[model samples]
Target chain A: MASALINVPAKAKRGDIIEIKTLMSHIMESGYRHKASGEAVPRDIITSFTCHFNGAEIFRADLFPAIAANPFFSFFTTATESGKFEFEWIGDKGFSETASASISVE
Target chain B: MRFLGAIATALLVVGAVGAAEIPLAERRSGYSFMKPDTKTMQDDDTANPGMLWVLNGETLWNRKTSAADKACADCHGNARASMKGVAARYPAFDKATGRPIDLEQRINSCRTNHQQATPLPFESRELLSLTAFVARQSQGAPIETGADPQLAPFVAKGRELYMQRQGQLNLGCANCHDDNWDKRLAGAAITQGHPTGYPLYRLEWQSLGSLQRRLRACITGIRAQAHDYGAPELVELELYLMSRARGMAMEAPAVRP
Candidate 1:
């Protein structure tokens, strides 16, 4: 199991490009690393992250082995209406975590 | 006899006054050396990654365990009130142990003695989280430290160690922190080594770490054999750093590069 934290404006104006920040606790192990005993550690990374605004996809990203562990993302998305924003992160070993934040727009 | 007593009284007052004069500005908070963005990251709780540890600590504070079934909150009540400025005063003298105890040792002492719980391992997440959480309570408070007569020997040793060169490099903490502060080393500006912000979030580590961990890094940087966690020498060094940092505001759980 994994945990996540999301930051978004509690209130915003319509059509405002609000900043969204997120952090997830994951190893994001690049599968290329070797253990002390000369064994290759299997890769485990968050392969995908998607943000949904009111059930509609606003942004999505396909992560790679290069992404650092405990991936943090800060992006901007226009506020269309007062609604909930959902975040989902999927990774190797069937690791999936989700979080949500809501914004009130005038 | 009355004349002798008056002379002793006069000497006592002078000594007390001399001891009370705090030399501020001899040290600077790590925040001043940080990039503007880094400082902003530390200033804003939402953006600070260190807050994650604080959040966990809050949860842990209220959660009960053991046969006695005690939580820190059960005894301390609200941490915000009870723990305020507590971190700023440590590594203070611990009368029970008749020794100096840093924040980490204090936390462990509480766990084993009061909570009846197993002590968390050094550098463990739970310990770091708890220490960070407690230290955060003292944010913005000025740090004040002095060596009590009982604790003077440790402080003296710490000061001696701070100036003593070690390793192949033969460099001491004072060489850089005191003599060459405000200069750049390896492209990073050097500030007077201050311990105010500890159990802090470091972007380089991408995790929270304690002051001892940072001190060990410095020791290793000089190619010296590093001390094990919770070593007495490290505690002494911490005490010295705190005393050097007297009157400076604490910014624990601070963000740094």
Candidate 2:
């Protein structure tokens, strides 16, 4: 039911600002709700996300349990002699997924 | 009485046009009822959560799940190439059962018969994924169900069910969808019920679900005992809906509020 979809511009002029969009499918349960049996649902969410540009950290987000499921994030960064943009998300239960996309900058 | 004469003629024209079915010129896709942002979300695969299932479906199609050691791709080939415009004619006649079966059932039938795999339970993630993927291939094709002669009786049965009042509220689908569509209901626009999209993404559910799922919700909303998933009655209703919306573009994996 949940999958990751990340988008990045394939090409951009040097020094141009490019938009990057990331979506992660997660329950993001806030742990505040009680079931019919009065048992608390455990909190599950991506606690942090970061993007590195050619090995340098460029964007970071700190998520909370209150975040909605399938959280989508969009941001912009200047396109410099692009090599690769790597993304990492860490969450509850040691959940981690990483993806890499490369862009050509002329 | 010139004004009275003109009003009588207009009412006569409407009555002659078959009041039960919306006129062709007024038939509109649910897309017209959506907010601009929701439409944008559906148009952009990157933002549409339903696409996630479609991507996984591609994986499942090639994974080869059964003891038969056959993948959907093995026989059907690339879904993009073989499945085009296929979903437009679902709730189709099945010779073996002599009953109509929706696309979901068709997929299961293929699995058990051709792939030697147990039928995926209705409402399972895999089923939703595969259906969305297949239906996506028919995105712009017109719905063409009820074309088979064998399906005519079922469509007739479906039409009866569609109009019959039921449940605690004694409200039938026709009461709202056919009679009062385009009007506001509980702050939401009541669209003329169209099933051109199936296995769609409903933000209320925050996931991709089948047409049957939506139907069950409506049934329950009327305080009715929601039919079991894969029930013939549900498929019948689906048939009736598809036939009603014939020639309309399909929009599977559609985003809905």
Candidate 3:
């Protein structure tokens, strides 16, 4: 039920290093904490996240239990041509989400 | 644990000054101590994790339940307009009950009486979501609780609870919030125990939680038995905190460390 938010410039210069920022709403429970009832909270975290530009891989990260909830990432990618930038996040319990933004290179 | 002595010593001085003459400048919202990044999260609607709960709440508000056969929107209309400044006055006196009730109880009563639906379970995700959603409407409004004559007795009770020491550690809320605020303990700053921002997203919890949830942690920290989520004691304390925090900007669904 978590929606992903991504920020990418609508237009960028060819060969420019464009900044991309993304944030996702997730608990990313590490399974180490105990509830009031003394039961351990189960682990549930985004295991992998990847970004592709024009159908080519650009950036990827393997998330771990140490990552904070509502994971946020900031990175730069070389703008090549006008196309869609696709992002995907895969996590425990078969959780997966994808979002895309269109980029136009000047 | 090592800082208990520092907290206690500070409280002794504040307690000796009596209640009336304390300068208003001492009152600071918990926001002041937040890391810059955390403050940014609270300020940015797009980045705050609490927005997730608020969005979920918006959906639930329009969805009809089996018992009511009507959605909240069916009667209340757009919450953005109807709920504006509503949260600021909460923990208000409920004339029907002849007692003060917090926002959570008010929401439950609406479910029971109007919607004919069972009250959402205390601290449940649905309850937190709805509460946050309603509270979001009051963002930037100033807190206006505790001024009613009928609410005076309850507020007094809450004040008494705030100052009374309890548990094995013999700690009262004032020990840290009123006296040692802005001071560090275990590398975390002590905030002034304000209730302006509730149903807040706490980084430590890694999720949105109600004020009662945070209060329980304080009680447990001092080795005291915690009250249940909807206990009257908690409600009274919430009322007192709100009154003490009057005029502070409401930041419901705030992000915290």
For candidate 1, lDDT tens digit of each residue in A16-52? 9899998777767889989999999999899999999
lDDT of 2 by residue, A20-83 (tens): 9988777677889889999998887889999999999999999997677777889999998968
B154-193 per-residue lDDT for model 1 (tens digits): 8889988887778765667776677666666656776788
> For residues A15-70, could you state the per-residue lDDT of candidate 3 as single tens digits?
99998888887889888889999999999999999999888899999999999988
TM-scores, all models, native as reference: 0.88, 0.92, 0.89
TM-score order, best first, reads 2, 3, 1
Clashes of each: 1, 0, 0
Q: Worst 10-residue stretch by lDDT in candidate 2 chain B?
A: B10-19
Q: Candidate 2: interface RMSD in Å?
A: 1.7
Clashing pairs in 1: A31-A43
What clash pairs does model 2 have?
A: none
TM-score of 2: 0.92
**Which stretches in model 1 have alpha-carbon errors above 4 Å?**
B1-23, B147-149
- List, residue by residue over B95-175, the lDDT tens digit for candidate 3: 888988988899899999999999999888888989999999999999999989899999999999888788876778877
Top TM-score: which candidate number? 2
- Could you tell me which residue pairs clash in candidate 3? none
